[model samples]
Target: MAIESEVLVIGGGLAGITSALAAADAGADTRLVSYKQSTLRNASGLVDVLGYTPGGDGPVVDPFDAIPSLPDAHPYRTVGVDTVRDAMAFFDTHAPRYQGHHTDANALVPTHGGTVKPTARYPASAAAGLASDDRDTLLVGFETLPDFNADHAAAHLESAGVPFDVHGVTVPFPGDLRAGAKVTRYAGLLDANPRVSVD
Candidate 1:
């Protein structure tokens, strides 16, 4: 088959789709193709600018401030800080309204795992979960769902020794969870089970 466009983007991942849309927005006819699937379907849905470097220390507080300390050939340095800012701006213009801590500070966001990681921008749904000294929170997990570990997460937050209280609860899954089942099935149960969310 023959497909024609001013701009052709290979890969239907997040990057490809964004680039295609951007090109179209810039008045260019764009076409995107992927052999397998978009990587977005397998992503954690968190947007992080930079995490710890190879064998480096803990997560970054202010990614921009730590940029200078990175190797001279780092990708962020190569892209230039302005480019990163522009990308963030473009994303914020879309859905979720990506937000951060202060102007250049990274926000603390919960991961699928038990740990809290730093993200340059996060969805508004996770804003309140950011690490703070005065936010009492509850972490809940499903018994059959392996995506989240409530006990480990709640314990980790408490061990941080912050001035906040953490509680963890393990609840049974509303739907039948089978081996190798997709995570979306679990999420569908939550959306369908009015008793769970409305309580």
Candidate 2:
């Protein structure tokens, strides 16, 4: 079946969600399609949104303002000063909604340069440790630099007896895993799980 939408978001990852939300907010009829229960479980979960905050317990150096001084070949050099400033402003506006009293009170805030406590939305300890009988097994094919151990994860799944499956797909991009390459891998994962309804 062919579904129509003004903005068809193919992934529910951070960038996708952010895009979908922004598009919808801008009056687009957005539809987010995901092949799994969440786009949060994969590499997206590894990202922490709490990089910097106003009144944060960290060094308080604005990453945007700091980007311009980096070496000529630095990734930030391409970002441009205006982009960083805009991002900093966006974060300044939205961060308060997610901040918690505990985070605000934390003494040591961790920053890129040093350790400084920053407000974050990580799962609470109790929630993180909760036992789950249901599990989804992802079968990753091909190797990339900084490889992850799927064998250990699979062993844990087997011990838990959670539902699982394995499959393989070739990587289109060989050698380096850049931003565009990662998106390709994400699409592959979605293709493998066609049953999921991306909403």
Candidate 3:
């Protein structure tokens, strides 16, 4: 059998894009599938990769600095320290140049201002801009206590001169948050969306 592609992504979120680009750069024909235009339209858009690390130029959180506590049975737990270091280096090398740029050289750097910085390269400004530029954005609002109404988000997008398609999703809830059933429900919603198609 011949190798078809270096990577085949099931979802078209930041992870998928980055993976596809990396694979394609490595000379691979990547295919990405998603329920919506891309994962950028969903809650993945709201992702904030900021978090505290123990060893850094800024302050550290000793408690959170601890590595994965998963048992040996967990595959991720087997990752070597060198692998993690190499990944961090790759991220540092690819960080956006404007991230560290500042208006006042004397003032603190905006990127370094916050105690917690983003782990992902996708900038909030860039994500927001993409959402704005794209027409007929479909924001699937979940119908629950913290439900996000499609019309509400649509209106805000409209005022910002952004076109959108809105729909509300009714997620099943067992009414037990601590049990962790909600996680599966949300995953199901994303799985239901399809790329190159509309719901």
> Which lDDT value does model 1 have at 86?
83
Each candidate's lDDT (Cα)?
0.74, 0.44, 0.42
Scored against the true structure, residue 161 in model 3 reaches a CA lDDT of 41
Candidate 2 lDDT over residue span 1-199, tens digit each: 9554598998877667777777886787989998775646543222232344433434333444444556677655776767644553454444444322233222222121112232223233212221221334343433441243345444544454334442223343333345434544655665676564422
Estimate, for each residue in 123-180, the C-alpha lDDT of model 1 and write its tens digit. Answer: 7667888775368888887777776788888888777654678888888766668744
TM-score of each: 0.81, 0.38, 0.34
Model 3 CA deviation exceeding 4 Å by range: 1-7, 41-65, 68-76, 92-199
Instruction: Give the number of the best model, judged by TM-score.
Output: 1
Clashing pairs in 1: none
Q: Write the per-residue lDDT of candidate 3 for residues 1-199, one digit (tens) a residue.
A: 8866656887777677667666776788777777767635444222222133323433222211333643565333467445544554454455553221211111111121111223333443444334324444444534442434555555555454433442333343323243333444555555665331223
Score residue 82 of candidate 1 by CA lDDT: 79
Question: Using lDDT as the measure, what is the rank order of every candidate, best first?
Answer: 1, 2, 3
Task: Please identify model 2 stretches exceeding 4 Å from their true place.
Answer: 1-5, 39-61, 91-96, 100-199
At residue 154, what lDDT does model 3 achieve? Answer: 53
Task: Compute the lDDT for candidate 1.
Answer: 0.74
